[model samples]
Target: MRTTKHRLAVVTTALLAAVGVVAGPSSGATRPGDPAPPRPVTQNAVSDSFSDTYADPSVIRGKDGWWYTYATSDPLVSGGTPGLMHMARTKDWSSFEYLGTVFSDATRPTWATRTSGLWAPDVRKIGDRYVMYFTVTDSTQHPQGDDSAIGAATAPTPAGPWTATDGPVVPPRAAPGGGWWWTFDPSGFTDVDGQRYLYYGSYFGGIWVTKVADDGLTAVGEPVRVAVDNRYEGAYVVRRDGWYVLMASAANCCAGPSTGYSVFAGRSRSPMGPFVDAEGTSLDTSAVGGTIALTQNGNRFVGVGHHAVVTDSTGADFVVYHGIDRHDPWLAEPFGINRRPMLADRLDWVDGFPRARAGAGPSDTPQPGPTLGSSLGITPEDPAAGGFTGMRVGPRDRLGGATGLVRGTASTRRAAPAGDVHVRLDVRGDKPLRVTLGRAPGVTVTVDPRGRTLGMSTSGAGRPLRDSTALPRTSGWQTLTVRATDGQVRASLSEDDLHDPYAEVTLERDRLRVGSAPVRLSSGGTVVDNVVVTPAAQDARELAPVPQAGALITGEEFDDASTPALTWVRENPQARVEDGQLRWPVEGTDLTGGGNQAGLLLHDAPDDGDWIAQTKVHLDLGSDEIRNYQQAGLVAHATDDDFARLGTVAIWNTRQTEFGREVAAAPDGRTSYGGALVGTAAPTMWLRLAHHRTAEGEHLYRAGTSRDGRTWTWGATWALGAGTEPRIGLYSHGGASPAAVASFDHLRFYRTRWPSDPGAG
Candidate 1:
């Protein structure tokens, strides 16, 4: 069963008129200045069929280009037991290479007994050796007590020949609440000052922080309370732009079939906090306001917690965590019997918060990156080697014009490019290689036999071209280049023979197969290799420059920032400039329980009347219990609501059954739509809500969420309402939470009008 974090709640209609059909100069027409439409950030279920009880999974790209993922095993079996640690490696998200338990047969330390369940393992490299930190609980023997402790191990490499220490580095401390406290779930990070800090805690107490000794083992000082009060676990940290961010898992986890885990985060000047939210509110130990970073989707899977933050080779941040397979609920039984393997998603920064691709699951395909060698192919059919293959073509290979060439053969390889790219193939045989590409206007196949004597044809187009001149046949091994460029086919033989090319065809179909001709032939096997295709590089015009230091306002340049300037404000209405510092304004009205509804609005005109528009939003409603129909978002595509005098109210409700069967309210009063919110008051958060129209649909409604405010966490998506011109804004009611004080900032808005006249070269 396939799982996805994103699910469609309603079918949306696209209004072509709103897209670009009707337009005027005075109407802030959709132009280069307008924000781009939201695209699907992450896909799901890369490696689907595994039940490895991996938790707190951390992934790092090795020098060899493979992603090394380390996780805590189940509390049962040889290596699956708690004290034991497990490791797996994958080049792509779809397949994994299990390296087995790393510290199973090692001597049992005094702090870790055979029955102790190991939890939350994090790994990092120092010099040449890999350092691992984890939490172990001897709960089986000490069933009535908490014997959880943080431990350390060393390995020559990520796969490991791990050497476990004799005892816990950070022993269980006395609990503030009285019982023998469990001290486990350790996360390690090196601060900008080159000091190593270990962040750990459990339900027995709140999250604590301590510095690591010079040896990278043992604590140098007493554990300090960084995050307290809430059920915070899985402490992970990363530094960006001088700020140290600490992310932790909150709420009841490991409920197996009914797990309710989500991620939350806070940031501070140093590794230890007083971490604050977007509203500049500190994480209250009594009412911690860790904003929801990401959540689990029932359709995709649940229990998205126990994560670790790692920076990829490209310096991109990613969160690796585990989830209960919604399709296989039984996998969560017997403690560590069937928990799924760990998964990863890219973290993005929207405004200033980290956001995961809303509605995304484990990536189905490995991310396009550096590969080992061009000779070794990376494809779905490859025998589950550790790393990902570029692309492969097999007997069942489908291309345009050709159906199935290598059918019934033992097995063949499907050819793909090095990275996310386009390629072309050169067929030098008498007959064309039968293959199918995507639907029409999809993938194009080109055949260049060097001369007119060679015959080429396309399946979707059904057009044939015959070369008149005879071409040289393959003596030993001649290479032919078949290029698929943006769904257009162009064939080239050698670098020198650039002239008199074979036929050029456009693909009309999606899935094209390559196979033999109607007449059976054997000696004419094509030697296909060097599948060369270049990925369309991002245009400079498309990428905004990275903001300078102390720029004060982010998204001001509007290059890399996804949320428009006005949109940022709608989600954070209270955000405003006060004596140089961004401040959340105290509410004077009861419009939405004192919740200020500031948002980005797209309009056809700078004025209020006579125009169409749309906008995106990010909201933090403060309490999940507050159900003010007014505490929602609004997008006036072509029409504005008379109540709020805005286009539409993309209202967010703790009562919306759309989130799940669970109560939307957190301990505090805040309500969350997609991701989990840590506190009830001043929860730092991110949301993306939009209204648009397309040729196939009218009045589209789209929404997503994120904890970090970078990567988007997708939620119910669809289209609603219709009009030629609409004005949009953020809508908040005055009466929701009795003390409800919602704030918004960083707002941006853009009109949906394409440029009519093309620019000159």
Candidate 2:
């Protein structure tokens, strides 16, 4: 038996290698280094937004050039309703318009009543009719141990008057040993050979595949184990480039922002059994797989899994899934309410395996759209444009005093103006206090009572702007100037301040305001004030990349002098380029001194997933005594309040630690419960971190790492919140004091798809 097992592993490795693929590190596949392919632009292409609550999303492209996405509703509100499946339509992945719930009813199913949420529904076009396959439970009981069954519905279009069958398509059964009752998270697929198969199972049994009858409503054969052997659930499948790809969800899910769920994948010649990792390890059917396919970054939140894969009008594959919101603080409650939203992201084959970019979250690049169009005047409920409330004293009364204030609305709007714009506000104060304008990218400008003097502070790597200019201040109103250019921005109190010989204040791009709560006076005073904002344009160059981006070395061809010191260029002549990738071949040198670091250092002071960052890491020394935290990974969406770090940590000799981690809001920059993992291992690695928005909440994920850049090992997974995006970078800590140098190279950043789901094998 041992010899046979060895032979099977060899054969599997050879077959995978011939396909130019390897098992992920944990799965024993070759490490992969290829970047995700750029998405083809299309008309009406829409990207996922922070407000979407898509989960277990199944997408399909119609013959009509329209793409439809079906997902579960907010689990918190669907009370006892078989988790209503919702729908959205889009031409491109760029944007989507919500359709409505696909499945909801006054009555419930027999096996699972209205209490058990409907879960993991998959949609496929069977002939001219659209068939939807899903799972529903018989009880709202905890631990999810009750009997579950697979059901189906049909509709003419993606948005359905979905009609359900009288009974489940696949009924629950006892496992071989009565270990646990078997249920389903049904997934459907059509192989190149015209074979129709349905994959289903949950934590009770590994994913099982069985042929579906031509009618598409019943199983044609007994179920056979296919992809995993452990505690895996939520199986999905898609065929690309002649290979049958299987994706599955591994780990705990459905706990709101604190859940631990991620997507994993494998391939097989047939839809059954012996699906191997890149390195030829059999997927554990009963335990979480050790390979991670997609995860969240800084702005992106929630652990994304339980997905459905579908092709778009152009035939590009896309994954749809739900994630929690990073900005919605309410999701922080344990066992309280779940608010994950459905999201979608494009997927592609890299070296014959499926890969997806991190989904959009609160902290990634803002999708290019019309900045919050024309403002509709201020209201007490507007987050960006509103007045103060709940203050011990108002802005004017507490001139030199301090008080508490909360941002009125939970949202923000962008301002549009013609030229250099001036923002004015009404003040009622006599003491000295500084007025500050807040903006994204952490931009801030402070104006003092001596209107002639202005000071500025930015989170990125730009010089501070300080100048003196006269400003208009009446007993009732005060106005401040904010300069705007194509990309850069400069602020001064007046024309006199702009002309000051020493006043060479220049900021990048037009001015934007950071949405802060109502301004306060000093600690023990009262004040009342109304903020008035306006915009004008000025001549200037585009704003430079924020100090965060500039501080790190991306590709070998890019560098900036004005960038900050978080990253540096080393002097190793041996560091050369290979196949358009940077390679460091030198050995045995203590290059850990300041400025000699191998990877980029990020100092943007963590924010959320509105930003994303990537860099390659190479480590030479391996030590069993090395601290478990000694590893190289990506740091993103970091703030003084909350942050997430994802990457590979070489633990003790036993295993390599894959970090899919998050730091939630804590009193002193610590997580309320510490970080969690999607999976772990000890090996050379490649890591990606992302934040995504969903109906339930914001989510974060971390894909595993590998050596030869082909295979990988699953890592950590965690949640940040909802509606908030943050910052990103590369991080290395807790190893040797003079930490063994970890070389990072070939970094890039791009906008990712939202509500990304993992496809099935």
Indicate the TM-score of model 2: 0.46
lDDT of each: 0.43, 0.46
Residue-pair clashes per prediction, in order, are: 167, 190
Q: Tell me the lDDT of model 2 at 473.
A: 32
Score candidate 1 by lDDT. Answer: 0.43
Give the per-residue lDDT of model 2 (tens digit) for 1-761: 00111122554344333322222212111112211113444211122442334566666644333567676545323233324766777654556676766665653344456566676677776644678888776533334456677888887665677887777787766567553455668877654333567888865666788888755788887778774433467877654333456777765565444455667677666656556544554564222233345555434455566776653211234556655554552233333445566555555455555555432212233222211111213331122234333333333122213222322222123332222233322223343434333323334454444453445545433233333333333232222334332234455322111011112234442222222212222212213233323332111122111112223323222242232434432344554445444444422321122222443345442333322344567654354343444556566543433555665554333233344333444323334322334343334555555334445655544443445555434344445555555445555444444346555654555344333332210
Predicted structure with the largest lDDT when compared to the true one = 2
**Model 1 lDDT tens row, 1-761:** 11112222221101111111111111111122112122223334433434345666776544333567776666423233343666777755556787777765455455576666776677765544567888777633355556677888886666777888776778766666576665878877764334667888865667788988745687997768887643477787765544677778765565443344777667788778878755454553443455556665323356677776543322234666776554353343342354545666665554445544322323333343222222213221221221223222323222111111222211213322211223323222333333322222222233334333323333222333222223333221122334332212333332111111212223221212221111111123443322222221221112111111121221222233343434433344454443322333323232222243434334232332111222223334444342344333343333221111221111222221112111112223332212223233224444443333544433333344444645443332222223344444444442433434334443433332321111100
Give lDDT: candidate 2, residue 729.
Answer: 56
- Model 2 alpha-carbon miss at residue 33, Å: 34
RMSD of each: 20.2, 27.2
TM-score of each: 0.47, 0.46
